[model samples]
Target: MKIGELANRSGLTPSRIRFYERIGLLKAVDRKANGYRSYPAEAVTILGLIALAQGAGFSLDEIRALLPADLEHWEHDALAGALTRKVADIETLQARLARSKAHLLHVIDEIEARPDDIDCATNARRVLTRLLGEDAEMPVASLRAKQF
Candidate 1:
C-alpha cells in the first residue's frame, strides 16, 4: 500500500509515519520505481503498536526499544523492563506530589493561624520567600521559595 493508504488505514500523518521510519520505530518501507514509499500489509499492525505505546506514555526512544523485531514472538523481558522504568517515574512523581500537598497544607495553616500585625506580616513574607527558594536557591521543606 502507498503511504496515503497507510495514513488512511492507520490515521497517522505521512510525516509521522516517515518520522517513525527514520527513528527506527517502523521498518524502512520499500519504494516504487518513482520513489514513492510503499508499505506492506503488516505496517498497520506496527503502526497500531506505536499508537498503543504512545497511549501508555512511552517516549519514542523507549517505544523503539520495546518494539520487537518479530511482533508475533515478542519477548516478555522488553515489556517488563519498560513497565518497570515507567513505574519508577510514576513513583518519583508521586513523591513530588506529596511534597507539594504538604506545602499547600502548611500554607493554609499559616494563613488561618496568622496574627494580623506588622511584625507578623514581615515574618510571614520572609517564610514564604524561604520556601520558594530565594537569593541562593536550594530545596527546602517549606514551599515559600517555590514560584507557585
Candidate 2:
C-alpha cells in the first residue's frame, strides 16, 4: 500500500506517520521506482500500536523503548518487565488522579465558605506551601491579601 492507504487504514494522518518514521517510533517504508513511499501491510499494525501507546500516555521515546528487539538478540523477559513497569506506572497515575480530585473538591468547599470581602489569597498560599513546602512559588499579594 501507499502511505495514504496505510494512513487511512491506521486512522492516523500521513504527516503523523511520517513523523513517527522520522522519530524512529516507526521504521520507514521502502520507496517505489517513482520515489513514492511504499508501505508494507505490516505498517498498519505498527501505526495502530503507536496510537495505542500514545493513548496510554507513553511518550514517543518510551514507545521506542517498548518496541520489540530482534528475538534472536534480545530476551523476551526484558519486554515482559517493561510491560509490568508500565502497568505499575498507570496504577500510580490513577491513584494520584483520585487524590487530586479530592483535593480540588476540598478547595472548592473552602472557597465557598470564605466571606466575600476577604480574599482567599492567604488560603491559596497556605495550600501551596503545604503541598510544596516553604520553597513554593507564591505571588506577593498572597502574603498580604486574605482574598483575591
Highest lDDT against the true fold, candidate: 1
Over the stretch 1-108, how does candidate 1's per-residue lDDT look in tens digits? 999999999999999999999888888489889999999888999999899878967899888888887667677987898799898988988898998899789877
Count clashes in each candidate, considering only residues at least 3 apart in sequence or on different chains: 8, 4
* Collision pairs in model 1: 128-144, 131-143, 131-144, 131-145, 132-144, 132-145, 132-146, 133-145
Could you tell me every candidate's TM-score relative to the true structure? 0.69, 0.70
Candidate 1 wrong stretches, greater than 4 Å? 108-148
Cα lDDT of all candidates, in order? 0.81, 0.74
Residue 21, model 1: Cα distance from true site in angstroms:
0.8
What is candidate 2's lDDT per residue for 56-95, written digit by digit as tens? 7778887788775322344468667867888999999889
Off by over 4 Å in 2: 69-75, 115-148
Provide the global lDDT of candidate 2 against the true structure.
Answer: 0.74
